[model samples]
Structure formats: structure tokens, C-alpha cells
Target: MFAPFRPIIKDPALRLAAVLLVLFGAHAATMAPYVSALAIRVFGLSDSAYSAVLLVASVLSVSASVGLGILADQRANRRAIALGTSAMLIAGSGLVLAGDNAVVFVIANALILPLSASIFGQLFALSRLAASTHPERDRPAILSTLRALFALPWLMVLPIWAVVFDHGAPLTAIYPVTLTLGILIVALTLAFWPRDGATRWPDPKSGLTFRQSLREMANLPILSRVVALGTINGAVMLYLVVMGLVFAATPGRGASDTALYAGLLAGLEVPFMLALPVLVGRVSRTSLIWVGAALYALHLGLLPLLAPTPFVWLLTIPGAAGGAVVLTQPMAYLQDLLSNRPGAGASLMALQKLAGDAFSAAVFAIGTALAGYELAAAAGALLGVIGAGALWAMDRRAARS
Candidate 1:
């Protein structure tokens, strides 16, 4: 379970990469679970507007990710890109805090924050490239471990947020916390992140024009699989979108309950996340992802059904087990799709996010329009299962051919 931590501790590059992800996760713990609430309840956006904000954010985030991925490949300068995206994150946080109004919230969420989201992919790309010289068999473990490191901060940070919110801190306190984290990310990058190819992680420039690079990503095998994983991810996205709302709306539950629920779910997820590498070669990645999708779907579908009672807590079991596989496995699977170009491959995380989030936003909008948050969650669960099956079928066909 802890095997992945060995090299990360011994090697400074791996250590720095690992630290950066933990920081990013800390920032995510604060921001992600609260976005829908902040937009609708605090910032005074309506359901329709909130849905639009999320859809636009997904498109912008993935566009920036794809562009940077291509640029990183050409320039071989993950350091510079990382620094720029970190700055964007800080700026986005500052924008929200400064204006403290719906208009600025819209700009930050739909434009700046989404653009900064590419930083997640950049961190993974840098880590993957840094480990380019490791044995082929060890690569997935390294990436999976980096992902686990990313989830680690959630265990600690979200629980603290839960405590703070319970103690009566304003919910918007997350912005300031996020701002501080972004600054720390910048400091870490400036102080420790290596220059381009400094560690001899060979640059993989395909010498393709911009259009040519995108065309490569447009290939059927890669796109189909990406969409499938994204579909699996959409359920998670929907859970984030509606969890806070459902909890706060429930008579017995309120804001603090929302935070604690998210925090506890995250806490359960970390241990399972650390154990992912052990399953790497023993099972096919898609098979694990498909099974994970089903398990997570069970949790998603049940979350609202049981929200008013203590049994809701049990959802964390499947949530953690499945969350561990889907969240960690996709990183390795997507990266290998374009293994030669580390930048582009890592950016697939962002693209998979784009597809998932686009679906999530649509379901949230349509479901809420037709019914309510419960319907949205159900729609997301169904999509996830179908997506997982589609991915399994696609891979089986490829194998037989």
C-alpha cells in the first residue's frame, strides 16, 4: 500500500512533484465542494445561471489545458507553464475576494478559475516527464502515487474546513484559503520546480503543427476512451454539484453537515487511493474502471435517497472503494494513450474532465429543470454506468481485432 512513497521520498524531483499535488488537493478541498453553493446560494445566481457557469468553465478549462499541453510539448518548459497557471489561480481567487459580487464570481468561475484548472494537468505532466527514465513497469505506480498524494491533502484539509464551518466561519472563507494555497503553490514552483528537461526527462516534440497535434488527439481510439472515462467521472462531478445543496436543504442537515459529509467521504477515499498501485497489472485498467464506475454509481444513486438518515454515512464505503480506482486509474490510462508526448498525454486528464463536466452540467440543468437535485444525481449515475460499459466494450473490440 505504501510502496509508492519510497522513491518519492528518496528523490527530490519526485518529492517536489508529490508536494505540489498535495497542495493542489488542499486547494481543491476548499474550492470544489463549495462551488455550486457559493454560486447559487451566496452569489445569488439561479439554477440556470449556475449551470451555465459550470458549462462555460469546463470549456475554458479544457481549452487552456490543450493549448498549454501543445505548448509544453514544443517548448519542453513545464516549469514556466506551471508558474503561469499558479499565478492565474491566485488571480482568480483574488478576483472573487475583491469584488465579492455575483458578476466577479461569474468572471472568476467561468474564466479565470477554469483557466487555472489546467495547472492540475501540468503538475501531472511534469511528474510523468520527471519519471521518464524509470522502468516501464514502474511508471503507472509513480503516476498513481502522485494522484494519491493529491488526494491526501483532502483527508486533512476538508476535515479542518468542516470544523471551521461548524464553528461559524463564513462559507466564503474558502476563497481566502484558496488564495493562500495558490500563493504557496507559486512559492514552491519558484523555489523547487526544475527547468525544462533539467532532470534529463527527454523532450517529446512530435514537430506537428498546432492543428496536427489536435488531430492526433482526435483519433478514434483515444477520443472514445477519453469520453468513456469522462462519463464515469460525470457522476462524481454531479455529486459535487448537488451534495451541498441536498444536505443544506434537508431538514435535519445544514451547511456543516455538508462539509463533514464531504470531508468524511474524502477521508475514506485516501487509504483506498494509496492502495491503487497494487492492482495495476493484476487487473486490466478498463475492467477496474468499469467496476469502479458501477460501485460509485451505487453511492451516487443512493446519496440523496439516504441523506435524511444516518445510513447515508455507509455510502462512503462504496464511494471510497470506487472513487479510489476511477480517480487514480484514469491518470495512468490517459497518459499512456500518448506516452511519447508527456504534455499532451497528461492534458487528457483535463480533456476527460471537459467531457465529464460538460455532461455533468447538462444533467444538472435538465434534471433540475424537470425535477430536482435527486433527478440530477440519478441521471449522473445512469450516465456513468452506460459510459463505463461503453469503454469496456470499446477496449474488448480493440483487443479482439
Candidate 2:
């Protein structure tokens, strides 16, 4: 069980990536569950406006991710990229903290924060490159272990946020908390991030011109797989949004309940995440994702119907098992699709995020306009299955070709 982390434990570069990922996850754990609430309930953006902002943010995130990824390959300078994005995170939080309007919230979320989100893909990109030094067979396990470590902070941070919110911290308090995490991220990068030309880290330079690189990613095989996986993974995005909104809108439930619910589900997922490395060769990745999408769809489709009752707590079982697989597998899979282009491979994650966010935004808008949150969640569930099936078909077709 613990064997997966041996590589991370032994390698300083890998160790640095794991530590930084935890801190980054900490900020996300604190901020994400509440970001939707802040946009709509606190800042008074309409549902349509909020979805539009999320759509715009996805654009920024993908642009930063892909541009920096190719540039990272060109210069092999992940440390430089990490430091810059970390500062952007701080600036984003400060934007919201200093201003008190919906427009400011839009700028923070849509521009600064989304650009900063590129750090996430870059972090994995760094680790993937570093892990290349270890035995080839150990690579998947090493990545999975780091991913679990990323989720580990949520176990601790979300509960803390619950306590803080319970004790009457303002909803906007997440900005200052994120501000602190951002500063620590920058400090850590300066203190421990590997040098660009370090012997320990082998940068995979794509060598393609910028236009050529972009054209490669735009290829049908790569883009279609990303889109299919992104659509399937969109279920999680929808779940996150509805979890906060629907759970909060329930008659007796509120912020504390939302926090605890998200915390417990995320908590349950940690073990499964840790356990996934064990299944590395025993189960096919595609098979696992197929099952995961179905289970996740079950979790999402039931969420709105059951959120009002104690029965809702039972969701942790399926949500954790399914969420664990869906959340981590897609990343490793995407990275593999562009195996040699570690930086561009990492950008695939950002692209998946962009596609998922766009799908969720559209689903959320249409579902809510047509009916309500339940309909939105159901739409997410249905699409997850469809996307998963599409991916299976596409991959099988590609394999044959």
C-alpha cells in the first residue's frame, strides 16, 4: 500500500512536488467548495452570469496552461513558471479582498485565479518529468501516490473551514486564507523547486514551433479524446457546484452542512485514492473509468433528490470510490496520451478542466433554465455516461487504426 510513495520519498524533486501539491490542494480545498456560493449568493451574480464567468475562466485557465506548457518545454523552466503563477494567486486573492463588487469577483475568478490554476498542471508536469528517472514500471504508482497526497490536505483543511465558518467567519474569508497559501507556495518554490537545468530533472523539450505545437494538440485524435474525457469528467464539476448550491438550498442545511458533507465525501475518497496504485496493473484503466463514470453518475443524479435528508450521507460510499478513480485516472491517462511531451502532457489536464467546465456551465444554465438544480445534476450524470462510452469507442477505434 505504502510502496507507491517510495519513489517520492527517495527523490527530492518528487518530494518537492508532493509537498507543493498538498499546499496547492489546501488552498483549493478551502476555496472551491465555497467559490460558487460566493459568486451567486454573496456577490449576487445571477446563475447565468455565474456560469458565464466560469466559462470565461475556463478559457483563461486553458490558455495559460497550454501556453506555459509549451514554453516550459521550450525553456525547461518549470521553477520560473511556478513562481510566477504563485504570485498571480496572491494577486487574485488580493483583488477580491480589496474590492467589494461583483465585477471584481469576476476578475479574480475569471482572470487572475484561472491563470494561476496553471500551476496545478505544471506541478504534475514537473513530477512526471522527475518520475521519469525512476524505474519505468514505477511511474504510474508514483504519480498516483502524489495525487493522493494532493487530496490528503482536503481531509484536514475542509474540516477547519467548517469550524471557521461555524464560528462566524465571513464567506469572503477564503480570500485571505488563499492569500496565505499563495505566499507559502511562492516561498516553497523558491526554497525547494528544482533548478531549470538540474541534472535530476530531465525536461522533455517538444522542439516544435509554437504554431506546430498548437496544431498537434488540435489534432482530432488528441482533441477528441480530451473532449470525451472532459465531458465525462464534467460530472465532478457539476457535482461540486450543485453540492454547494443544492445542499445549501435544502430546507435545514446550510454552510456548515455543506462543508461537512463535502469534507466527508472527499475524506472517503482519500483511501481509495491511496489504494488505486495497488490496482495499477490488475485492472485496466479504461475499465476502471467506465465503472467510475457509472458510479459517479449515480452519485450526481441522486444528490439533489437526497440532499435534504439524512440518507444523503450514504452517498459517501459511491461518491468516494467513484470519485477517487475518475478524479485521478483521467489525469494519468491524459499525461500518457502525450507521453513524451511532459509539459504538453500536463497541459492536457488543463484542457480537460477547460472542457469539463464548459460542459458543466452549459449543462447548469440549460438545466436550471429548464427546471432546477436536480435537472442540472441529472444532465451531468447522463453526460458522464455518454462521454465515457464515447471515450471507450474512440480509444478502441484508435487502437484498431
Question: What's model 1's TM-score?
Answer: 0.98
TM-score of each model, paired residue for residue: 0.98, 0.97
Tell me how many clashing residue pairs each candidate has.
Answer: 0, 0
Off by over 4 Å in 2: none
Write one digit per residue (lDDT tens) for candidate 2, span 166-223: 8998789888889999999999999998887875756656689999888878888889
The segments of candidate 1 whose C-alpha lies over 4 angstroms from its true place after superposition are: none
How displaced is residue 156 in candidate 1, in Å? 1.0
**lDDT score, candidate 1, position 94:** 98
Worst 10 residues of 2 by lDDT: 198-207
Q: What are the clashing pairs of model 2?
A: none
Model 1 residue pairs with clashes: none
